[model samples]
Target: MDVIVSRSGGLAGLWVTWHVHVDEQPDRDDWYLLIRELPWEEPLPVPPEPDRYTYRIRCEPHEATLAERQLTGPWRTLVDRVQERSEPERGRPANGSDRTRPPSSRRPRRGC
Candidate 1:
């Protein structure tokens, strides 16, 4: 299985990170990390149009591993970790209306 996560607000300048693991050697193209940084403007796209400076980490599995039992999952784990480290709750609240454009070609819901 795979997971994805996004983090926004809180610290003035902070970076988001994620780690993913699969049952076996899966196609690299099947999964990836996408980062979209919100610009200082109105009507920001859901994904911020894949900001050139956005932060993301793509997971690559080891070459020799096989018959895997556990997977690293998705960035959600990292986001949860960040939340635990930063605030008392699960990071900041997501205001979807703040965005003007809908989610980009990317899949899944967009949160801020």
Candidate 2:
């Protein structure tokens, strides 16, 4: 699953691009995701229609639950990936040039 963040087009929010899988079987429905985080002044769009394959979520102060969708992999892997991207690149030699990467790109363990 690739995640792309775009802030061009005079948009006042972040656009997250990734793949979402929803299906009867465990982790079945899969499609690219385009999550837009609009500004506070922007009006919220209509709620997404319920479906087994794809959906949209909006959270106040940017918080929400993904427990059901997270059945695809470990949670820590997801957190670490998000955290690393959100951090400042001050310590690194160059942006996106870290060689000693983590064991996995998934979120980090909650307890760890």
Model 1: residues with Cα > 4 Å off, grouped in runs: 24-112
lDDT tens digits, residue span 1-112, model 1: 3232233322332323233332222542333222122111222233332322232322222111111111133333433443343322122223433322212223332221
Task: Name the lDDT of candidate 2.
Answer: 0.26
Q: All predictions: root-mean-square deviation over Cα? A: 16.3, 16.3
Candidate 2: residue 71 Cα off by (Å): 11
lDDT of each: 0.28, 0.26
Worst 10 residues of 2 by lDDT: 4-13
Positional deviation of residue 40's Cα in model 1 after best superposition, in angstroms:
29
* Residues 1-112, model 2: lDDT tens digits: 3331111111222223222212222422221121222222333342332322111222223322332243233233333333345432122212243322212213322210
